[model samples]
Target: MYIAFALVLLFIGAEGLVRGSSSLALRAGLSRLMVGLTIVAFGTSSPELVVSVEAALSNQGDISVGNVVGSNIFNIAVILGITALVCPIPVHRQVIKVDAPVALGVALLLVLLLFNQTLSRFEGVLLFSGIVAYTWMSFILARREASPASADNEDILAVTQSRHWGMDIAFILAGLAVLVVGSRLLVEHAVALAGSFGISEAVIGLTIVAAGTSMPELATSLVAAFRKQPDIAIGNIVGSNIFNVLGILGVASVISPMEAPGISALDYGVMIMFSVLLIPLLYTGRRLHRVEGGVLLALYFGYLFLLWPE
Candidate 1:
């Protein structure tokens, strides 16, 4: 019952967030794609931030660190893979040149930070600053490159013009609040259930907790894809993966230094592999085709298979 309720809330929260964020972006003179990359992506990533912080506070370093690492992997492989299968997502030039490379850099940075198997408060502050800089750079670039709104953007504006700006802000806040709560319930129940099967904290955090908290991203991206907003669909995943590492982990490590002894180098390697693979897949024809999507799905499932016993 709790899991079912959590799913409902996740769906509703994701719907509200997508509607509110997309409309708000159009009104604010930001492109829908930028909106997806920044606002929608950060908003959807809130659950991850919450989960990791809570785990850090409780001194469960494995869960805290594993959650972000696993969530990033899931965002690229599972979320993007499923979204591409629904509709081949166009690769934004900015993403390939700037955003994806930034994502890879941060993943490498995380590895460096974890060299001592610990994330110090100083390291956390540095990670946090990267997110701030990244967000500022993204906005500056977005405004500088602003063009006339597309038909889709105009249509969204028209639909939302009837409503007030306050309502949009309200929807965003409410959606984020609901998403955090829903993901908490889902993760707690899921961890409990996984414990019954004798799953380790590291595995539960990497797989179940990561997937549970990422439900918002999955729902939002799928909804965006169906709504014919490919930028939002694609941007949301790339942006979320970046935010998952820089934002969520940064905040968690700041709260309490995390020691991730249980998270092996192989886990980090897999995460980097996925991040690296996206570039070539997206660079080819500048679109993620259904066949590429299947490859991603197969890789993701294969990774899961490797994680569990025979």
Candidate 2:
């Protein structure tokens, strides 16, 4: 019952966030892709940042690395896959050429850092610095590309302006409130339930807790797909994954360095594999088809099989 209620709040909160954030972007004459990458991505990623920080401060810090690695794997394989199945999400060429490659590079960098079994304070700063660079780069790129979008973008922008700025601000704040509260409720119960099953902290953080915190991203992307905003849909996943690795991991480490307690290389390899797979899979047709989505989802379950409680 609690799980169901929490999901309801997540869904509601995501709706408001997508609506308000997307409106804000359009009103600003910015591309939906930019809004999806920044606003929606940050909104959804808030849970990861909060949970990881609190856990680090409390000394249960091992979960930080596990949670981040697992969440990134899940985002592309599960969230993006499922959204693709909904409407066969279209991939932008820039994403294939620019965004996906950067995400992959970051993934490789993460693998090397994790090899040491410790994310040091200095490394945390480097990762956090990347966040600043990536955000500004995205803004510059988006503005340059905005003019090429067809008249449809103009129509959407006009519609968004019909909405009062005050209402949009209210929506953003209200959405954030419910999203945070709901994520907390869900994470607390989820960890307890996983513990009852004798699940390891690493596994719980990697699977259940990670998935719970990612509810907003899942909801936001699914909504974007249903609304026929393909750019927003895929952008949310790409953006969230980048945020998960760079922003969330960086801050968590700065607070308390991350180490994957008892986490195996095979597990880390699985995370890295999922990240690498995005490149070719997306490039095949510059689209993620329903069949491919199924393939990705199947791979996610396979990873879970490897982690299933002894």
Candidate 3:
């Protein structure tokens, strides 16, 4: 019952988070692409961020790593899968040329860091810095590309001033607070549920917990796809992947340096392979057609099959 309630809260909080953040971004004069890339991406990833922090503080480092890695896989395969099935996601050239490679690079870096059996404070700092730099660069590029014909910043400011920024901020804060508390409840119940079934925490995080947190991504991507805003949809996924790898893991490691568990290697391998497999679709004319979406979905199902207990 607690788990079910938490799931309900999670969905509600995610909806509020997305709408609130997107509205705030627009009110602040951000372009649609920038809103999609930064605000939307960060908002959708809040669940993963909260879960990873909680898992690290609780000393469940394996769950921390598993959550981020598994969420990324689900973000690409499942979220994008169902989104594409609804409406084909047209890949933007910038995503294919810039974002995809960066995501792949980050995945490889994660693998290399774990190869040494731990992600130290130094490595964490490096990863965190990379994330900051990437974000700064993305914002700069967005500003450069923004058209002069775009909506006036004064109009944006007027809209923001007309509304209660304080109220919106409060709503966002309250929603996030609820989400954090709810994530704890969900994770705790999930762990108990998994133990009763004699399932490993890693496996539970990989399947159930990962999928639960990824609901935001699934919802956002599907909505974006149906609206014919494929660039936003794809950008949201790519940005979330980067944040999951670098931001979530980096901060968690700094809080509690993760020692590579026995299961880490398999998880890392899957993450890298998944990122690699995306290269062709991302680069081929900068569009993920229905065929590419089908391939990605099939691969994800195959991965799930492999994860099942023998």
Candidate 4:
């Protein structure tokens, strides 16, 4: 019951956020794709941020790493796959050339760091700095490439329709509040339920907790797909994955230095494989088709198989 209720809040939050952020971006003369990659992406990734930070502070640093890796894997496999299944999502040119590949590189970086047996505070600083740089570069690009003329022309209609800065801010804040509450509820109840059933610890962490932290991404992407905003949908996924590695892990490591570090090599490989798989999937016909979505979903189930026995 709690899980169902949390899902409802997630949907409502995601809907409000998508409309608010997308509209705000459009009003600021930014394209939906750019807005998705920036504002929506950051907003939706907040749940992962919270989970990782808490795990780090509690000395359960492996959970921090697992949460991030697992969430990123889920974001690509389940979330993106489902979104594409709902509606074929167009791969923006910038995404193919820039964001998607950046995500791959970030995943690779995480794997390398894990193999080193520690994510030291210095390394954490480096990882955190990368996101800062990426966000700054993104803003500059958005300003230069966005079409202000569209916003100007739409302004009259927006005013007549009562869409303004105040309303956009309200939507964003309200969405954030709902997302935090929903994520917390879902994670708590899921962990409890899994424990009650004697489910494998690995399954609970990699599935329930990972999925819970990724609810915001799931919600935002699903909503974007439903609204026929393919660019925004894909952008939110790719961007959130990048933030998962660079932003969340970085912050978590800096906070606690992540001492519990035993991520399986196979698990790391799977994460990288999924990240790289996006390139070919998106490159083929320049969009994620339903068939590819099925393939991703299959790969995710395969990943779950690996975790189940471990």
The residue pairs that clash in candidate 3, if any, are none
Off by over 4 Å in 3: 25-28, 148-162, 260-262
- List model 2 lDDT by residue over 185-276, tens digit each: 65566667667888777787788767867887887677667777565666667777788889888887887876665567877788778878
Question: Model 1, 72-99: lDDT tens per residue?
Answer: 9999999999989998888768888999
Q: How far out, in Å, is residue 97 in model 4?
A: 0.7
Residues 1-310 of candidate 4 have per-residue lDDT tens digits of 9977876776677657666776777787765545656766876777677666766776656667777888889999999899999999887677798889999999988877777667889889989999998888877766665675335323312212125788988987998788767756655676577678876434565676778768778766776677665556677788888888889888988987976445677778888999999999999888999889999999999888877765
User: lDDT values of the candidates?
Assistant: 0.80, 0.75, 0.77, 0.75
TM-score list, all predictions: 0.88, 0.85, 0.90, 0.81
Model 3: residue 234 alpha-carbon error in angstroms: 0.6
Worst 10 residues of 4 by lDDT: 153-162
Candidate 2 lDDT for residue 262: 56
TM-score, model 1 to reference: 0.88
Error of 2 at 234 (Å): 1.9
C-alpha lDDT of residue 267 in model 4: 70
| Model 1: pairs clashing at backbone N, Cα or C within 3 Å | none
In the range 1-310, model 3's lDDT, one tens digit per residue, is 8877777677777666766776777778776666667777877887887887788778776677788889989888888777777777777667777888999999998888877666787888888988898898889977876764224322221223227566567668777878888789878998898789887888878878788888888877776676665556788889999989888888878877776473456677887887887778767776677877887889888888888672
Candidate 2, residue 293: the lDDT equals 93
